[model samples]
Target: MIKVGITGQAGFMGNHLFNYLGTKSNDIELISYERDFFKNEKTLEAFVSSCDVIVHIAAMNRHEDPQVIYNTNVGLVNQLIDACEKTSSSPKIIFSSSTQEDQDNLYGKSKRDGRKALEKWAIESNGEVVSFIIPNVFGPFGKPFYNSVIATFCHQVVSGEEPNIHSDGTVNLIYVNELSAAFYSEIISNKNKSTIKMIPFTSTKKVSEILNLITSFKVDYIENGVVPNVSRDSFELNLFNTFTSFIPKKHFPKKYIKHEDDRGAFVEIMRALTSGQSSYSTTVPGITRGNHYHTRKIERFAVISGKASIKWRKINTDEVFEFILDGKEPAYVDMPIWFTHNITNIGDEELITLFWINEPYDQEDSDTYFEEV
Candidate 1:
């Protein structure tokens, strides 16, 4: 197994990459890293020496003073190099540079210089360094303003704030999960070269176009409780998932409109603009089901009969969210990607739940990972 460590394991991209690597425990052993290690030479050296590969992702992205951003980013690369040299370690370093390297900004200059410094270190120390010139990245849990336009727009729309576009220029974007997969592939490749690779963008969109898409998501999914028309693995689906991640926990357990007549009462379980597979399950009293999560699937659980308690917890997070639903008042809770969840029958009698997923389950590639909520 390759012993790998990420320098910025707690930051947005770092967290995504770290969690993605966690899912490959059989082939890789993750080395823990903290931001504080940069402040201590001994600790940093120890971290560098213990790893077979180090993913250098920690870097300053924004600051009031552009020079501070530049200095901090370059300083971080130098520090990592110092730690490697001090410990006589020659671990392969995978540096997360950016497409900004070609732009006329201090941030871009910092990335260029950092990559150059790492390349120099690799040549001198007989080490390996693969620098990725990455495009704009977007995904769940990104900082509203600091991360990217998608993150800022998602947060603004979800928080009832209008998103204003300063520039409608086209942008090349890559989803965080996709970027993480690329990083994982690089780690597995274990190439012995100090070269740079331009990571291809998965989607391209104008700033205004993205805003329109996410705004429609708010209107359809958030307000009307209708899933947007998006196919599996489409950019729209990824953006929709990212938009949903910003929704407040209280927004869930949305009550379904009940239509009552002389014979009986009926409630619509789901309304989707796209095709999906629907299934139902009956659970005995006090029994729990679904200690699993999906990475790309859109799923919903509706309590059609009996009382049920649905719980959710984002992977690698400590906080948990829960909702209670009853048959009398039919309601549902949608599952966001990367959050482990479970449903428990809380009532005395058997509980029935209607499940809807964006796609039919394929055993060969289920995209389901089991984890406790």
Candidate 2:
């Protein structure tokens, strides 16, 4: 079992690392780092001893003062090394450095100095170290004004304000989950290779390109109810998911553009560009709609009437995820690729569901796989 400890458990990168580690069913435990990590020697030593691997992610990147950044970061390294030295068994360390570390700037210098300190400690203790020079990581729940420029753009767009692109420089981004995946790789591979570090990147795009993509995603996917061709760009799918997750809940299930007359009204719920079809299913009380899986087909269920309990279970897994939806609160849940799923009418009345598939359903090639939930 791997006992891992993360420095910035509440911060963006640290939170993502925490979540990713939690998902893996491998025998791994998260070592708790106390709040007064620097001040309390007993807590620091105990925590350091408990961890088999330590991930240092807590560093001040936004401070204006160079000295503050330098002092805080280097001091963090000092405390960590001191704690580790007190323990007989030294743990492998993963330092979260930055691409800016090579630049001639204060933040860069601070990160560079911090990495040097870690390198020195690793040499002295004969411990392993892998300092990842991470790029800008963007994802959901990031602070609007502080954490990421993507968050700023998404917030501005959702707030109906003009997105401000102060700089046109290209920005590299890795979804936080992707970053976590990289870290998990390091954890699973306990080989000692600390001499020289290698930098990795997941994706990169121009600032204008990313901003424009998000804006289009909001318009086409959210407003016009178009399921995007996520196959076109995988990273863009992550960006779209992050942008949509930031949209205010009150603006969800946005009112459709209605064509009205004296008799009735016609509202187009959604329209896909190349393929896909909309489906409707009505389930009475004590009845279920689906107990199946899909290999390539992507589906979404929006409960437009009554109530439902949508459930998903990964192939050959015992765990099942359940999501409740009702017409009173309009929302949609997308199905997983290989996960078997179903929707049950939990309310007293009939359950009405609207389904969207990525491709037009064919009687001959439905692409649907069934499994009992």
For candidate 1, the clash count comes to 0
lDDT of 2 by residue, 209-239 (tens): 9889888877886666786667523686677
Clashes of each: 0, 0
Q: Cα lDDT of model 2 overall?
A: 0.77
TM of each candidate vs. truth: 0.98, 0.77
- lDDT winner: 1
- Report the lDDT tens digits of candidate 1 across residue range 197-284: 9999999999999999999999999889999998987899999999998998999889999999999998888899999999999999
- lDDT against the true structure, each candidate: 0.94, 0.77
The prediction achieving the highest TM-score against the true structure is 1
Candidate 1 TM-score, true structure as reference: 0.98
